[model samples]
Target: MIKTFVPAPFTTHPALEGGGILHGFFGRQGGISKGIYDNLNCGVGSDDLQAHVLHNRQVLTQTLVGADRPLITPYQIHSPKCLVVTGPWPNGESEQCDALATTTPDIVLAVGSADCGPVLFADADNRVVGAAHSGWKGAIGGVLESTIAQMEALGAKRDRISAVLGPTISQKSYEVGAEFRETFLQHDARNSVYFAEGAKEGHFQFGLPSYIVDRLNACGLAKAEWTGQCTYLEETAFFSYRRTTHRQEPDYGRQLAAISIT
Candidate 1:
């Protein structure tokens, strides 16, 4: 994997600016994988060549933090589980969790997702950071809340933490059946505001990013914003699960959103 092929990640977040912390929302570029995976495919669980996946991970880790620092991501299961990391996990070990929080410097906490929202959190004042894979299920299950709680347990303050949600599928591309809308409404009637009528009957467009940001704000983290990039709509810049499915692709690659305390 050469540097020329890899596009630099789009960095954002007011609290994380000024080199106080290192983070990026990486898309589908800059690696050796071919075919549908293309390049910079960071998902280890994808069926792409394992060697290419490892190389891509190495490229991203080196670019985001440093070649000397360690990068650790969990085996995401869309659960509310959050892990607090003090040190890097051993090679070939992944905890079954949706989010990771850490206070250790140079230890990168990362999460992978294609269509799902990848959230990066930083409490620079407390020297704590976290990353979460927030799909509809994970978001509904309280993954963001759990991540904030875990960060707080590690000395992060709710008011001091800044959360930035990375690129994900937007409402225009996220159509669901009536049952999907009903499920959310059953959880809370207020959640109905997150959905809108679709082009066809018995379907609705879901606003996942807004819902996630609303959750973050409700949790006391005043600073939270989406990058305003839609993975499904931005074909050249992102990998979308719905887009892949609509195209009838065999498999799709996942993107990485990571953060590390300095």
Candidate 2:
């Protein structure tokens, strides 16, 4: 059994600060995973030791909502699906989805990401919270919107909700091919603003955080803001898939962005 554990202080956005909601954008520090996983690797899907991942997740849950409640993060496949969770998944069995919303207090709704956007949502007035994992694929496919829809279904008004995008890949470090940019253009021509010239002639850098927050803001939520921390650049504090790939490492860790209604 895991002993009582506490993690490093996590990042929080002003919009989500101090409410009936307990929320935090966690980094990859203060965990027990070894080697490439290092510390605070909450991804059960990673190649890290199952014991370490489970222990880290338990630490995160305790940090956010105490040890009595459960923290649930579904299997994210870069799709736009969002699940409305009324209770903890049975015995830590997670469903397959990219986002989660809940009216049930004490259940920590979390999303895991490495370089991709980890968005946490809250409507303290309605005692509802949501969390989403939005990679470029999920963002374009509408996972953020899906989360908002579920929140609304649980009595959270769009105008009363606040969302925060946690540490993600910054445009400067996120070079992409022209075909990737075209996917956004085909969806909406105005999305060009999220793309900038990459170092290479045929490549572009994508602004994932900006795009995710923009989509959230367009939903007419009370507030949506990015924590302004880049997972790629903050090597000592966060885990980044792109950074790991660039280094030719075998695997990477995923950080959690979570919210619990109280």
Candidate 3:
């Protein structure tokens, strides 16, 4: 039998509270991983031991749902692609997408992230839930909107969907170059409000969470909120890609944010 472990310092959102749904914004705590990966590292794509990664994921799913219910995650490639999940994929089979939505109860929709935002969505009225891995690329590419659309197709109303962003790199830790700023401005001049001068010249501090919340609200979600946690800034609570890159680490673990329709 696979050993069961529990996550520590898990987070939940008030907007998602009281629904017939169970969700968590899990941090990088509780598990058996070691070294740079530490414990509770859930990134299957990371360099952590494959067995350990599987065990960690198992712990997360079992804690939120049960040992019988499987947790499903996509082979995310920072795209806008979203899929409607009806049942568990065959072993070693995973979809190539960034977001997943389902009305099926007990099954968990999971998203993995380091510095990227993991947003959980639920329309309790219709028993539909979704999870998305939104980096700057996925955000700009419309992953959030795609997830909502998929949920709507699965009988969820845009006005009833509640979205909450989990731990992510806040603007203070997200610095970008001139080209990046130019791209957003090119997308929409209003996007400029999300950018501010960085400590270094020619660089801007990007507000990814704010931008994501704006997108969610504009997409007609009934409620939206950022947990106000920064992956890079909160070393104890999250794993940060930018921090790892800054420290020039060989690899970094990924945290999980998941939701299930009860």
For all predictions, the C-alpha RMSD in Å is 1.8, 1.3, 1.3
Write candidate 2's Cα lDDT for 8-116 as tens digits. 5698778986668888899988789988998999999999999999888888888777665677889889999999898878776889999999888778888999999
Q: In model 2, how many backbone clashes occur?
A: 1
Give the best candidate by lDDT.
3
Candidate 2 vs 3: which has more lDDT: 3
Residue 185 of model 3 has an lDDT of: 92
- lDDT per residue for candidate 1 within 201-248, as digits (tens), equals 989999999999999999889499998889999887888899999999
| TM-scores for the candidates | 0.95, 0.96, 0.96
The lDDT per prediction is 0.87, 0.89, 0.90
Mark the 10 consecutive residues where model 2 has the least summed lDDT: 1-10
Residue 180 in model 1: shift from native, Å? 0.4
Q: Pick the winner on lDDT between candidates 1 and 3.
A: 3
lDDT tens digits by residue: candidate 3, 139-164: 99999999998998999999999999
> Which ranges of candidate 2 are over 4 A from the true structure?
1-3
